[model samples]
Target: MPVVLSLNIAQRTVPVDYAQEGATGIDKRPVDGPLDVRAPGPKGTAGSGVAGDAIADIVHHGGEHQAVYAYAREDLDWWQAELGTDLRNGQFGENLTTSGIDQTHARIGERWRVGTALLEVTAPRIPCRTFAGFLGRTGWVKRFTQVARPGAYFRVREPGTIASSDEITVVHRPEHDVTVELFFRAVLTEPALLPRLLEAGDSVPPEIIDLVHRRTTVQLDS
Candidate 1:
């Protein structure tokens, strides 16, 4: 069974000297015990965020579709090798650092029973300038995009508390061709593949669906 190896949250946003926003909530720290997860509002809009987590940019971060970000320990290990550095849990700004699961391969709309909260996989986290600044890596945005192992975001279906070490069980998986890996690649690399995202129906994150629709509209007009 997959388990939550670390539960993390940040109370205050960290200063990102290079970003125009000046601060970022990407610096998350590990925490003990349980944390509440819930839908604070409409699906596409920002939720209150994890009980103790502070999301700096509401325009781009937060939202019901991205209520919680998750990354696998395995992926982090891979990055560690590439960067030649040690990465602590939550270093990637994920609310949950999970073990024994391939998060990138999780199908869009997949549901997981995490602690007492039920979460549905919605979309993939897209790296940005703030993320690059946080890492202080040169050309980090391009590097991350090319790596294309963007972690998955999930929406809270059943509001409840989740703690470190909680077992994660896949309760449901929709019959869809869109996996998190494919979704990331489509959104960032292959605009033509955007139409393929429609197969997930309403399960695809609304924001991404809108993007694909917009791209399709542009193609038709052109």
Candidate 2:
């Protein structure tokens, strides 16, 4: 249940230095590390929500795992066009990008061991305004939603160092037929899938599951 591949990293604050990276300040964090990560505050950034990690402008962060992405091992000239050019060459904001597995199928509570690092699938990323802006389209969020097959985010369950090209081995894949993508889709369109999502509710975060319930309510009313 594992399809290991290479790994890489890049700075997200390009064209904007620590001084000019704006309020968000680049949003940089280690690809795989413990939660509550911090960094050295940017100049004059006393309380700019930027963690004071060793890295400068270590702001604009997320929870245990800020970002995640997936791709097929082979060249993605075609997949690139669909996901936009920013992620075609594996240069997106993703912390871990690899091939050989159906990432959307990674259910909650599932875990993987890449090199020595232990990662657990937390949830599918909810497309945000930042992502829409990064791709330069107001409808980018909707487009991404239509596809809704993005990889799953992983919490660094284990703290260990891993180099690029390490194999990703899947240690578990529970009895979750309703994948992350399916849940995302049901929340988006299908009302019938709501029950399944609700049945598997415990596996998903309460906030997200609550959102699905909200949507179901609206659809029922309509």
Candidate 3:
């Protein structure tokens, strides 16, 4: 049974040189009790879906599409071994630290009933300089991208509260093979896989779809 091992929130922002604002809320920490989840309007305006969580960079983080972020504990464990360091839940800035689920392969548009909130997987977490700076590691973004195990991002379908240990039930899955890993690779690493993203239909972000269309059209014309 897939369950949330930790419900995390950014209680405060931490100063970081990598972020545009010179501070970031990437240092999320686990908290007890139920946390409210909701569609936080749009990017450049909204912040985190989880109550009390912070998003210092409005231009790049948060919004309806990235309401919540979930990282599987298994992936964190893998990173722990790879880096030979201790990684606590929410260390990756994920709102939910999940167990018993493969987030890397979770299909886009897949819906999960977590506690009372219904979440739809929307995208994968793109490695950023803030993440790299938080880890204080060189070439961290490239290393993470190479692994292609980026955790999943979710948009709130039904607003509610979620708590640690809440069971996650897969209530719906789109009939497409566009998993988080596939989407991440398509958008970041493999341009050849761009056309494959079309099979995901509207499950993908409109901007990404547009990118694929433009790229493919340019290729045809050339």
Candidate 4:
């Protein structure tokens, strides 16, 4: 059974050279209390789905589509071994650190009943310079992209309180095979896979759908 290993939120913003605001909330820490989860309106106006969690980069982070971020503890452990360092929950800026769940292969549009909240998988967390700078690792973006286990972003469907150790139940899964891993590859590395994303239909993020359209138009013109 999959469960939320930790419910984390940014305790304080830390100054960083990479963020546009000169600070970032990437250094999240686990919180013991339950958090109210809800759609934080739209990007630029919204912050984090979890109440009290901070999103310093409104232009690039947060919103309904990316209302919440989840990362598998298994993946984090793998990184811990690979980097030869102790990695903790929410270290990757995820709101939920999950265990016993394969977030990489989680299909787009999959619904998970977490606590009393219903979350729908929407997109993958793209590696950014902020992430690289936070880790202080050279070529971190490229390295993370190469691995393609970028974690999962989700939209809040039913607002509720979620706390650490809440069980994660897969209530629904879309029929298409466009998993989070595939979507990451399609958007970042392989343009050929973009067309296949259509199989997921409207569940595919609008920005990605736009990319697909642009590619299709360019190919036709050529």
Instruction: Tell me, by TM-score, which candidate is best.
Output: 4
Judged by TM-score relative to the true structure, which candidate is superior, 1 or 3?
3
Regions more than 4 Å wrong, model 2: 1-61, 64-77, 83-90, 198-203, 212-222
**Cα RMSD (Å) per model?**
1.5, 6.8, 1.2, 1.1
**Per-residue lDDT of candidate 3, residues 66-132 (tens digit):** 8899999999999999999999999999999999999989999999999999999988999999999
Question: Residue by residue across 100-214, what tens digits does model 2's lDDT show?
Answer: 6666776766767876766666566666566555445668678778776656656556655554466688887767676777767766666577667665545555556677778
Clashing pairs in 1: 46-63
Candidate 2 vs. true structure, TM-score: 0.64
The residue pairs that clash in candidate 2, if any, are 4-168, 6-165, 38-53, 39-51, 39-52, 39-53, 40-52, 40-53
lDDT-better candidate, 1 vs 2? 1
Candidate 3: lDDT of 204?
71
**What's the residue-level lDDT of 217 in candidate 3?**
94
Q: What is the C-alpha lDDT of each candidate?
A: 0.86, 0.52, 0.91, 0.91
How high is the lDDT of residue 190 in model 3?
93
**Residue 4 deviation, candidate 2, in Å?**
5.3
List TM-scores for all candidates, in order: 0.95, 0.64, 0.96, 0.97
